[model samples]
Target: MALRVLLVHQSFPSQLIAVLEALERRDDVELAGIGMNPYARRGLRYRQYSPVPVAQTGDIVIDDLASKATLAAAAAAAARALSYDGFVPDVIVAHPGWGEALYLKDLFPRAKLVCYCEYYYLRSGGEVNFDPEFPPAPPEVLHRMRARNAITLASLEDADVCVAPTPWQKSTFPAMLHPKIEVFHEGVEVPPADNRATDRTASGGPSVSFVARHLEPHRGFHTFMRAVPRLLRADPSIQVSVIGSDRGGYGAPPSDGRTWKSVLLEELNGSIDETRVRFLGSVDRRRYLDALRHSDVHVYLTYPFVLSWSALETMGASKAMVVSDTAPVRDYFTDECAAVIDFFDSRALATRILSLLRNAKIRTSLGGHAREAFHDYELTRDHGRAAWERLVTSF
Candidate 1:
């Protein structure tokens, strides 16, 4: 008989989509969820909420009271309505970040629980990257938030297993939780981009591309903009294409009428040559794949972040990448495999871009090695299926 499974997460499709997608494919496991709706159109239905800026801070605190109330109400409605034809799961796998699991523990006490552990708060310098403009800290606020995360930690104790994406995340939990933790990567299928060929240079210039949501300061948009003039001066044959959404809306609406993207573009006005830079706002999947495949080099920069799907996508596509030498990235790729540069140093970033543009042989070599590494360490669908089987068998 198939095992019935319930998955809980406040934010569903962001990181948990891979596991959900894998579980949905199985014939032996029943999957259901109590997660945030990514495409919810109505405000009356539970809307997505984020306390910190998206993509800016990884360690975020969702308002626990609101989340608990939402989950409890949903559970009550599910029980009264006999949702899913009175189906009760035997096991539960949830990402316990947003305190949605608090009510779930009571709702499904008999089911074996499994939690997805993303990160734990620490006091180290790398813990907080505060912005002076819209400051996220005074230490006290973080302390309160950490206390709220404790609710999540407590909920995980009820879990029979913990799924983690990286060693960095697995190590964050207590040693007792370690015994139950399993390491996995939420992987992406490499879209068919390797077959398509495109012009490497646009109008006698090297074609470079950047893929990220247009959030300021975090994804290193400002830093990349700073490096552009230097890069253009060094090699006149270079053009850049940035791909992302232009809407100013974040976790919620901005009180001010301007988005960070518009602000940055306005700030860099005449300094940037419109002919050399193109802002292709929110391209379709095919266009995104084309952008990655056609580029001579892919640039990624972040301040002490866990791995991004875009970074892995670039690797999967075998595009040469110039990545930031932060802890999370350095943990995986050694200096020999990728072009590493310090996040704060624009000169170093510009220099690396220039070097990669001038040498096609070195670019090809790095791209080859990166694809090999992706197959070895990053692909997760098969591994995730096996892990799900083990978790179900134990029950």
Candidate 2:
């Protein structure tokens, strides 16, 4: 009989989509998926379940636990319905952060449970403390952050295996859990970016791009925006494409009820050449790739946290880059590979971007190197697709 697998995530079709699609192609594998939204694509389907609501209690920690437990309960109910339909899973792959995988083992004791261990939060070594500008995490907040690990910890104790995208991310978990964890990134696929074939430079001089999921402090939106004023003031021909939504992710939202983009724009006080800068919010993949195709250089910045998929995509696209010198980022590229700079230094960021923009020969050389380095992280390459396949089969 083919291996019966159940895929679980709060949002389906995320990192696991590659794995799911790969499994769907195999005659030896049978797959079903569970997510918050109803999802069906590429001849595969998933059952959606509403997150069961929980009444808000005054306690932050208790309310968090209660809410997750409710979600866990909902997931458990969905799995039970599947079991009733004679679809007992042999393996369960889940993103456990939302507590969806909490009771899968109870539903199918014989199944091997695999949890996507994206990031393990540490009050000191992780994101909260990495930015000095933010007020230090208070004892209560620190306690809450530590408590936030409860769901993952419980899932880990029950999980047969855990997968983290990077070695640094895997290292964040306790040393004891290291034995169960594997570093497996969902590979990105993009052609090497060479602006030579394009006639964009004739249309406009030295265009560059910036991308993030949400323009927030954690992704260094403010730093990148701060760098923009100088780039605009220095070069009259230079144009910039800033791609992403004006919301927050990972880090806390602004206390003053303004988006970070608005805050930065207000801070700049009309200093930048707004006419040259295009804020292309949440562009489609075609436009994103098109922007990359037309650009001379790309900039990516981030805190010492989970690596953004966009960063990997940028490297895979093989564009000349200005990247932040964070621990997670160092895993993919070096200073020799691209222009690496301090995350907080807006001046250096602008200077490096300006330098790469002016030099075509240097851009081509760095872009080629970036593409070569990207192979190990690509889906079709040896380490990427092969490694993911081997792991899924081994289970």
Candidate 3:
């Protein structure tokens, strides 16, 4: 008999695309999905549900709790509907951050539950309070952060297995849950050296880049922008590309009620070369790679939060980079692999970028080491399609 599996997320196959493709290829495993809007794959069945609307009062923490509860209720209804169609799964793997996993165990008591524990909020040793420039975390703010973990804790309570992507990410959860969590990453394929993006600098001059889903303080966009003027002043021919939207994310919004990009750019108005800096807001994969390839160096910085897949992709492409010296980055890079700098100090960031830009040998060496490291990371000690299969089948 085929082993039945159900994968759950707000959007089916968002981060689970790799896992979905892997399972769908197996001859002995039956696959299905439950999502707010699940995609129609060739062999995989999907169930979609409209999430229940949540009403808001003035209290954000209370509103968030209500939102999670309603989403859980809506998701549970979809799962129950799946069973009504005679498709009970043997196991369920879910991303629990948004509260989809809250009531799943009750729906399928016999089925094993695997919770993708992405990250647990923390008042310290995490994103909050890390940036001193941001508003101080008062008692209410800390309380609100803790309240948001209601779903995360409940999901893990009955989970048959818990998975976190990296050691640093896993460490962010409460110590009590540490014993049950498995450290595994959904890995990326490293493209061969010859297939990497070649020198296609649009201006045919030296270039650098910074990428993220949003240009905000959380990803060190402000600091990267601060370093730009110094870099441009030092080299007239250097061009820079900034990727992602002008939106803020994962951190507090700028108090000035404006986009961080605009705020930072206005601050740097006369000092930096506006014409040389290209803010490619939200690009496709081809353009992203082109921007990356045309660069002399890439800069990726983030808070002590979830590591971006962009960082992994950058490594696979073998781009020379200056990275934030944070735990999540240390998990994938070293001094031998990429340039590490203090996330706060723009002066240090500028110096590192200038040093790498000036030295072709070191940039080449860093890119080479980064590629080697990318090929040998947790995907070996931790994951791959085979690893995902092994974990799924074990349940």
lDDT of predicted model 1: 0.66
Which regions in candidate 1 have their CA more than 4 angstroms from the true location? 38-84, 125-127, 130-136, 174-176, 193-204, 246-257, 266-269
CA lDDT, candidate 2, residue 195: 43
Counting clashing residue pairs in each candidate, in order, gives 1, 0, 0
Ranking, TM-score, top scorer first: 3, 2, 1
How displaced is residue 112 in candidate 3, in Å?
Answer: 0.3
Worst 10 residues of 1 by lDDT: 41-50
**All candidates' lDDT scores?**
0.66, 0.81, 0.84
lDDT of 3 by residue, 1-395 (tens): 89999899997877676577778888998888988984798888788878767768978788878888888898899889888988898989999988888898898999999888888998778888898887778877777778778778989998988888888989988899999888878876553352233353667778898999989999999899999999988888889999998875877777878999888878887786779988889999888877877777899999888999888878877788899998789888899989999999999999998898888888888898888888778543125666677888886
Per-residue error at 82 for model 1, in Å? 5.6
Candidate 2 or 3, higher lDDT? 3
lDDT of 2 at 156: 88
**What is the per-residue lDDT of model 1 for residues 16-105, given as tens digits with 9 covering 90 to 100?**
566566666677866665544553322112223332322323333434445454564554344323334665767766767656555555
Worst 10 residues of 2 by lDDT: 194-203
Residue-level lDDT of model 2, residues 248-361, one tens digit each, is: 577777888889888889999998677788898998988888887777788998888988877777777667899999888988888766999999999999999888877877
